[model samples]
Target: MRTIAYFLVITLICCLAPSADLSAQLNEPAPIRLRNASFEDIPRNSRAPVGWYNCGFPAETPPDVHPDPMNQFQVGMGPQHGRTYLGMVVRDNDTWESVGQELSEPLVAGQCYDFWINLARSKVYLSQSRVSNKPANYVTPAKLRIHAGYDFCDRQELIGESDMVRNYNWQEYAIKLSPTEDYTHLVFEVFYETPTLIPYNGNLLLDNASTLIPSPCEEVVAVNSPLVNDDQKEPISTDPVPGPVVVTQPTTKSGDPQPDPEPQVQLGQSKQVLAVDAVFEVPDITFVANESELTPESSASLQEIVDFLTIYDNVIIEIGGHASQKATADFANRVSMRRAGSVVEYLRTRGIDPRRMFPKGYGKSKPVCYDESADCKRRNQRVDVKVLKIE
Candidate 1:
């Protein structure tokens, strides 16, 4: 009789376990999501992308949706991803362009997030200068400023700022954000090199943004991590996203750690010919959470594949997107399939022949690692290239 009662108790606990899990899930905070994150829209001058609101300086022109196709400003760089990218300029008159959006969820206070965005420069951003009426090429490099605010265009606190983005090639920048207060809006804006008395014409190109993935406070480089410092003082304000806010607080007293230096990856390297069945693992592929879009940093490795294909013209290949073990086989398959399709689309934009490439998804059946830790799971989420045929 005691054995039967023990079995009944075990069954009761098992029945309630699912309900407890569901309740915990319901109590979790909703992730903050950005709308139209890739900035896809009709390319136009002085227009913000579809979902982002224009928050440029008062009376100044708004940020631009680039690759205008008409090429009025002499800027015609193709986007790293999607149809159009963003073009923001810091004018000689000290004004700049920016754009903003309300978050899907408010950023909680004292939360640390790992944010990533792709930034580049246009060498031929021709526009009439505010200082001189003649057309000036906005070729100088500029920095990026990200901000969180209570309302549209309100600069409540500066979250992330970047060094001068000098590379013309697209590269992903990981910006660490530490917010002290809960906020609902985020802004991205362009600013000039710091410690300069005079502002000059400069341009910044933006594409392929990542969602703010919650991260351990001690990972990578620490920028504005509240865990490191005890005081609640504001670091020097470079500028906020959407617009530049005049700094009202004191700048850091020299000893505080500066932002991590910009990452540099040389593009356009030659590659050896790939034979059939040769599997090449791309080391830099990172995607937005739950989305298949490749981050800008993936360009470095993706370019190698392009170079390989361009040289070995007869090689046919398969692109496979793999995911970690999921709840069901069908769910894993669908996720991997979408990721593979996104890579194919990116290659197509770069002039790769669609006929020579096949997209496949491996799902959880093939994980690079089975440890099941978060880092290991991230490693398991990957894209692989297999030479299918050598025509």
Candidate 2:
């Protein structure tokens, strides 16, 4: 009888333990569904897909519902999920295209969620460039940005974004969206590979968007549906750490009244669809030897950081610096710290919030390679931006 009582108590404890975890889990509302999410629209040019409204700037052209049967601008890609898909562009003139819809339920702040969408690029999105006023291929790859706003195209909070859509065929992007506040509206916009630095010509194709589903804060990325990039990250921001494309104007041979251009405004954002431990190498970011001053040639590369920070407003990052073993530990530590702080300062000049970033120097403590060769030393001397928190 005593043995039976012990087994009963053990079973009760085991069952009760999981229930205790429920307290940490949020009481998320039901899974939200979108109306006509697959973008079932009749083929048309300069118009948004059915059920999704145009969210671009005033007088700016709306996204197109393709494959126009007419094959306007040479965008004839077939839909992977339905009869039609959405096409949008970013132009050198500083304007882009987007669409938005009301959410079935408002996303609660501090709750975690994710959604899936199919994205690709068109090889021959033929259009004229505003800078050249001549026929230019809008082929430079672009990306999809997901924003949460209260009204049409408000873009109040950026919730998710995909890596550059380089592939021509349709590929699914699983984006984790962690909103900083409650939002009743959502917007889908196409942006350049880097959001404001170059505002060049590029296009993005989108279709078959899935509804936002509540997910565990620590839920792992979908194994069967991998992220478009090799890295696995969740959308969280850490405060006090620091960080951080193509646009094409859509117009055909036929003369149409060009839309009023929006003033040049660049948005620096955080990585919302990322895991907290994610580390990214900012390409072409280099500094003078033993000095914290960034090399002049690194301007374009550094601009990429500005664009990323503009969109991810709800997260914080760590600008971690490293040094080779050639220098003594003390020297290396100071060098790395100054370099990391220099990167943070550069972003501050570009108008990023200083509170979102802090610097740390690993010095020679963490080397990618130990050899004394220049190649190995250069490899070890690098900078990494680590996401520390998502607010």
**Model 2 global lDDT (CA atoms, 0 to 1):** 0.74
Please list the Cα RMSD from the true structure of every candidate, rounded to 1 decimal place.
Answer: 19.1, 21.4
Worst 10 residues of 1 by lDDT: 242-251
Residues 1-391 of candidate 2: C-alpha lDDT, one tens digit per residue = 9999999999999876654334333233446767667776556688876558899988677888778556669887788875678889888888888899988678888777767777777888887888889998888778888999888677898888887777777777777788989898999988886636878888988887776777766764441122344462322222211111011222322333234333222222233335566677665667887898899977875776664564455569898899888999999999999999999999898767899999999999988788779888877888877878878
Model 1 per-residue lDDT tens digits across residues 1-391: 9999999999999876656535544443434546667887656788787668899877888888889656888887888877678999999998988888898779988877777677878879988899888888998888899999988877788888876777666666668788889999988889988987899999999997876766546675423211112373222223223212122121233323234323222223312334567677776677887778889988877766664564355679898888876436887788888888988888877767899889998888888787858888877788888889977
Q: What is the TM-score of each candidate against the true structure?
A: 0.51, 0.53
Q: Stretches of candidate 2 above 4 Å error? A: 1-26, 220-391
